[model samples]
Target: MGSLQTNELTLSYGKEPIISDLNLSVPEGKITVFIGSNGSGKSTILRSLARLLKPERGSVLLDGHEILKLSTKEVAKKLAILPQSPESPEGLTVYQLVKQGRYPHQSWLKQWSKEDEEAVKHALRATSMTDFHDRPVDALSGGQRQRAWIAMTLAQGTDTILLDEPTTYLDLSHQIDVLDLLFSLNRVEKRTIVMVLHDLNLACRYADHMVAVHDRNIYSQGAPEDIVTKKMVEDVFGLSCDIHMDPIFGTPLCVPHGKGRQLLKEKKFTEKQRKATLVPE
Candidate 1:
C-alpha cells in the first residue's frame, strides 16, 4: 500500500492562502472522505496532496519522500488522481481514453505491452464499462461517463487513487453507484481511496475515515460513528439537525431542522388533550 501525508503545509492560489499550517495522514488501504461546505478548502487539500498544486510553505510526502522532488513518472506509478469535471477530447472512445492511463508505463521501445492490455481490460471490468468500451465519452449518460473516467484511473494500476467530487451532477441513485464502486475498489483491491464529498450522510456511510474540514483546517476526523454528531453538524455546516442510524446500513443519518411544517410534541400535552386532538376513529 502507498502512504500520503502533508507536513505543516500552507497552500494558496496567489497572495491569499486557502490552507495554512495543515497536517494530515491518509490511512493506507482504506477509504478516506473529506467533507465540508463550499470554499472550505477540501478540494484544495486534495489537489495539494496529489501534487497538482504546489504548497507555499511545506511539502507533500508520498511514501515518506517529498512528492515534488520525485520524477513525474515515478509519482504516476504509485498514485492516480481524478480532478473534478475532467474533460476528454470530443469523440474519444472509452477504450481510447482508458488506454491513455498507461502513458507513464510506456516507452518508445515498448509502446504497447501485454501488461498494459491486461490492465485496461481489468479496469473496464472493474468499472463495469466492458460493454461500453467503444462508446464515445460524450454519448454516455452522466453515471456511465463518470464510470469511464474512474476506469481510466483504475487502468493506471496505482495503489493510491484520489478523486475530487466524483459524484457531482449525478442523481441520487448514480451517486450511490459511484460510491459503491469506490468502496469495492478499497475493499477488494486494497487501494488507498481518498475523495472530497459534499453529501454528509453518504460520506458517513462510505468513509472508513471521515475528515471534516472547517476554516481551512481539519475540525474532526475518525470513524463517522465516533466523530459525527448533532453538534459537529452544527459546527461544520451551521445547521441544527438530529442524527439517527440509517435503516439499511446503520450508518449515521442526519435529519436537518429547517423551515417547514413542524411535528408537535405529544409529551407536552395532557393525555385528554392529546386524545381530543387526534383524528376520530
Candidate 2:
C-alpha cells in the first residue's frame, strides 16, 4: 500500500495563504474524507496532497519520498487525481478518454500492449462504462460523465486515488451512487481513497477517516463518530445542529437548526388556556 502525507505544508494563491502549517496523514487502504464549509481550505489541502498544487512551503511525501522529486510518470503510476470539475475535449469518446490513463505506462516502443488493453477494459467495467464506451463524453449525463472520469482514474492502476468533490453538480441519487462506487473500489481493490465532500452527513457515512478543516488547519480528525459533534459543527460551519446516529449506518447525522414549523411553546399561551388544555389531558 502507498502512503501520502504532508509535512508542515503551506499553500497559497498569490500572497494569501489558504492552508498553513498543515500536517496530515492519509491512512493506506482506507477512505478518507476532508470536510469543511466553503472557503475553509479543505479542497486546497487535498490538491496539495495530490501534487496538483505545489506547497509554498514544506513538502508532500508519497511513500516516504518528496512528491516533487519524483518523475511525473512515476507519480502517476502510484497516485491518480481527479479534480473538482474536469472537462474533456469536445466529441471525445469514453474509450478514448479512458485510454489516456495508460499514458504513464506507455513508452515509445511499447505504445500498445496486452496489459494496457486489460487495464482499460477493467476500468470501464469497474465504472460501469463498458456499455457507453462509444458515447461522446459531452453527450453523457452528469452522473455518467463523472463515472467516465473515474474510469480514467481507475485505469491509471494507482494504489492511491485523490478526488476533489467527485459528486459535485450531481443529484442526490447520483451522489450516493458515485460514493457507493468509490466505496466498492476501496473495499474490493484496497485502493487508498481520499476525497473532499461538502455534505457532512454523507462524509460521515462514507468515510473511514474524517478530517475537518478550519481556519487554515485541520481542526479535528478521526472516525466520524468521534470527531463530529454539535459543537464542532457550530464552531466549524457556523451552523447550529443536533447530532444523531444514522439509523442505517450508525454514523453521525447532522440535523441542522433553522426556522421551520416547530412545536409551539406552552409559555406562549395564556395561563388559563394552558391549565384548561392540561386538565383534560
Candidate 3:
C-alpha cells in the first residue's frame, strides 16, 4: 500500500476554483472517505487524485513523487481509480473488461501473459464476480455491474485505489456488501482505499479517515470521531443535528433535526391527547 498526499492542491474548472488550498494526506493501507453535499467538489478532488482532471495549481504526490509528472502508464501501475461513471465498450464481457486493467503493464510485443490471466481471475474471485465473468457487462444488475467495475480496478493490482460513490445505485443490502468487500480489501490485502461517500453514517462506519468538503474547500479532516461534530454537521451541511456514537459501528452518528410534517403531526397528536385527559373547567 502507498500513502497519497496532496500538498496545497488547488483545482478549478475554467478559472472558477472548485477546491482551493487543499492539503490532506491519505494514510497508507486504510479506508479514507470524503463526505460533502453535492457540488462540494468531492468528486473533483477524487478526479484530481486520479489525474483525470489536472490541478490548476499545486500538486498530487504519491509517495513523495509528483503524480502529474509521471507517465500515464506509470501512474496506472501505482494507482487505479473507479470513477462515479465509467463506461464500458458495448458488448464487452466481464472478463474482457477486467483484462483491460492490465493495459499499463502490456506492451506491443507482450500482450496477455500468464500473470495477467491470473490477476484477472483473482480479481473476479475477490469481488465474487467469477460466475459472471462470461456475461456481457450490460446484462448484469447494477450491483453486479459495480462489482465488476471494482474487479477491473482490482485487476490493476495497484497499491492505491480511488473510488467515487461506489454504492451509487445499490440497495441497502448491496451497499453494505460492497462496503464490506472494500473493508476487507483494506484489512486483508493492505490496499489503500479512498472514496467519496454521500451517506454520513456509512462514511463514519467504514472510513478510517474522513474529510469534509464544503463551500468549494475542505471544511475539516481527521478520524471520524475527532472531526464529525454537531457544529461540523451544521456548518458543512446546513443541517441541525445531534452527533452521537453509533451503537453498532462505534463511530459518530448524526441525527438530523428539521422542519417536517412528522414532527408537526406528532406534536399535534400529543396536544390532542393532553386536552382529552384535561378535567372540565
Candidate 4:
C-alpha cells in the first residue's frame, strides 16, 4: 500500500492558520483515527490529505510524491475520501451513487469495463448494501445510508480511504455497525483507513493508531493504550475523565466525570442492578 504523510504542513482559512508545521504519517494497511474536540482541525487535516483543501505551506505527500503535483484523477485513483454526512443527489439510487466512484478510472478511450462493474459489486456486497442498491439513497435508514456512502468509497478501488466524522448522527447500534464494518475492512482487506472520530472510546476501540489533535496540531499519537490517558483526555477535551481498559476490546476507555447518580457508594452493584438503575422499566 502507498503511504500518506504530511511534512511541516500548514493549513489556513483565508489568512489565519489552523494547522501549522504538522508532520505525521498514516500507517499503511491499518486503521488510524484522529480524535479531538470541535475545531481542533481534525477535519482540516483530513481534507488536506485528500487534496480537498490546499495546504498553505509545506506539503502533503502520497506515496512519497507531493499530492498537489498529481492530477485529480491520479490522486483519486490512489485514494478516496468520504466527507462528513455525505449527501446524494435527489432521486439517486444506491447503485447509481456507487457507480460514480468509477469516474476516475473512465476516459473517452475506455468506458465502463468488467473491472468497474466488479468494483461496484464488491463494494455493495462488502458494505452489506447489495439489497439496497435499487433503493434511493435517502430512503434507507441512517446506518444503511452511511453504508451506501462507504460503498461508494470502496468502489473507488483505492489503496487508502479517508472519512471525516463518519459516525456523526448515527444511533448507538448503527454506530457500532458502521465501525465494525470499517474494522473488518481494515483487517480483511489490508486497506489503509483513516478517519476523524469525536467519540473517544469508539475511536480507541477501532483504531490501531490514534492521533489526538489539539491546539492547532497533533497532541499525541500511538497505539490507543500507549497514548490515551486521563491527562490526555483532560488536556485535549478540557474535561475530567477516567481512563480505563475496555474489558471486551482491551482498548483504552474514557469515562468522563459528570453529574449522575452515584450507585457505587458503599456497596458493589451487580450487572443486573446497574442495568435496572440505568434502564427504565
Candidate 5:
C-alpha cells in the first residue's frame, strides 16, 4: 500500500493560483478518481501530487516525507505519472518507448537485468499491447496508443500511479477497458491508482474514492454514495439533477435536468398537454 497526502496544497503557474488550499488523502491500494468541470483544477492537483508542478504553498507528502524535497530519481522510484497530454517521440517503437520507463531503476554500471525484462513483459501484457510491442507507436490506433502509454507507466513499477485524463480520445468501450484494467491493477496487484476523469458516471462507477473539485478547490470527496447528491451537482456544476443508483455499478449516478433544444413538434405537444387540450384539426 502507498499513501499520498496533501496539506493545504496551493499551486500557481504565474500570478494566479490554479489550485488553492487543498487537503486530500488518497487511500492506498484503491482507485481514486478526481472529477470536475473543465478548468476546475483537477489536472493541476494531479500534476502537483506527481511533483510535475511546484506548489507555491503547502506540501505534498509521499509516505510522510515531503515529495518536493526528494531527488527526481527517488520520486520516480515511488511514483509515476502519465500527464493529460504525453508526447511521443517520432519513430519510437513500442518496445523502445516502454523501455524508457526503466530509466530510474537503472545504474550506469548495471543497466539491464532479468527483473527489468520481466517487468516490461508484464506491463505490455497487462495493457494488452504485447502484439504491438515491435510496431512504431504512431502507427497504432488511438485507443491502442493509449494502452501503450499506460503500459509504459506500468513498467515504471511504482507503488503509486497518477494518470491525468487517461481516457481522453477513447470511445466508450475503450474507456471502460482502460478503467477496468486500472481497477484490476489496484485490487489484484495492490497498486495505488489515481486519475482525473471528465465523466462523472465513469468516476462513480469505477472509483473507490472520489474528489470533486470546483473553483480551484475540492468541493466534495469520499465514497460516491456518501459524497454525491442532487444539491452537490447543482452547486458545483450549476445544474439541477437527481442522484440515482447506477443499475450496473450500484453507485450514485448523476442525472441532470435543465433547458436544452428540442424538436418544435415535441414542444408543441408539451404545450398542448399542459393545457389539457387537443391540437386543432
Candidate 6:
C-alpha cells in the first residue's frame, strides 16, 4: 500500500511560515480532501505533500522513507501531482502531453516500448479523450482541458495522486463532471486521491476523510459528518451556517446566514420543508 504522512511539518514562502508544525496522515485507497478559507495554506500543504515545496522543518515520509532522500524519478514512480491551473505549450496536443508522463520510465537504452504505448492509450481512454487525442490542449473547453491534464497524471501510473483545486474556474455542470470522474477513479481503480477544495458540500460528499485547515494548523480531521458542525463552521470559516442533511446524497449541506434575497418571511415553517411553498395554483 502507498502511504504518505508528515512529521511535524512546517512550510513558508519566505521567512514567515504559513503552515507550522502540523502532523497529517492520508488514508490509503480512499479520497481525502483538504478544505479551508482563502490564504489559509490549503494549497501550501498539498505542495509540501508532493515534495514540490521544501519543508522549513521536519520531514514528509512516503512509505516510511524520507521523501527528500529519494530521486525525482523514483518519487514520480510512486506519486503524481497536478498543480492548480496548469498550463501547456501553445500547440501541445493531448496525446503529446500524456506521453510526458512516461518520462520516469525512459532511459538511453530503452526508447519507446509497447508497454509505454499501452499506458498512453489507457490514459486517453480512461479520461474519454480518445477522440480528441490529436487535438491541441489550448483549443478545448475548460472541462475538456482539465480532463486532458488529468489524463497525463493517470498515464504516470501512480497509486497516489495529488491535485490542487481541481474544480476551479469551471461552471457548475463541469465541476460535477470532474468530481464524478475522480470518484470513479477512486472507486474503480482504487487510487489514492488527495485534493484541496473550496465547496464544502462537494467535499463532504466525496471525502472519506476531511482535513480542516485554519490558523496555521489543522482544526479538525475526521469523517465530514462528525467534524462539520455549526460551531466548526463559525470558528474555521468565520461564517454562521446551518448544517442539514442533503436530500439525495445524505451528506452535510451548509446554508450560510448571509445577506441574500429574503423571499421567505416566516421563520416558522414545517421541519420537512425549509423553504416557502404554495398549496394551490
What local lDDT does model 2 show for residue 71? 92
lDDT of 1 by residue, 166-218 (tens): 99999999999999999999999999999999999999999999999988788
TM-score of every model? 0.92, 0.92, 0.92, 0.92, 0.91, 0.92
lDDT of 4 by residue, 17-55 (tens): 999999999999999999999999999999999998999
Point out where model 5 deviates above 4 Å: 261-281
Q: Which ranges in model 3 have alpha carbons more than 4 Å from their true place?
A: 261-281
Please provide, for model 5 over 23-81, each residue's C-alpha lDDT reduced to its tens digit, 9 standing for 90 to 100: 89999888899988888888889998999888999999998999989999889989999
Question: All models: lDDT?
Answer: 0.92, 0.93, 0.90, 0.93, 0.88, 0.92
Question: Clashing residue pairs, candidate 6?
Answer: none
For candidate 1, report its TM-score. 0.92
Query: RMSD, each candidate, Å?
Result: 5.1, 5.3, 4.8, 4.6, 4.3, 5.2
- Candidate 1 differs from the real structure by a C-alpha RMSD in angstroms, to one decimal, of 5.1
- lDDT for model 1: 0.92
Model 6 agreement with the true structure over 1-281: per-residue lDDT tens digits: 58999999999999999999999999999999999899999999999989899999989999989999989988999999999999999999999999999988899998889999999999999889999999999999999999999999999999999999999999999999999989989999999999999999999999999999999999999999999999889888998889999999998999998433242334344534444354221
For 176-223, candidate 3 gives per-residue lDDT tens digits of: 999999999899999999999999999999999999999878899989
lDDT of 2 at 155: 97
- Please provide, for model 2 over 1-281, each residue's C-alpha lDDT reduced to its tens digit, 9 standing for 90 to 100: 99999999999988999999989999999999999999999888887887789999999999999999999999999999999899999999999999999999999887889999999999999999999999999999999999999999999999999999999999999999999999999999999999999999999999999999999999999999999999899989999899999999999999987532121233454657657656332
Off by over 4 Å in 6: 260-281
Which pairs of residues collide in candidate 4? none
Superposition error at 118 for model 1 (Å): 0.5
Give candidate 6's whole-model lDDT: 0.92
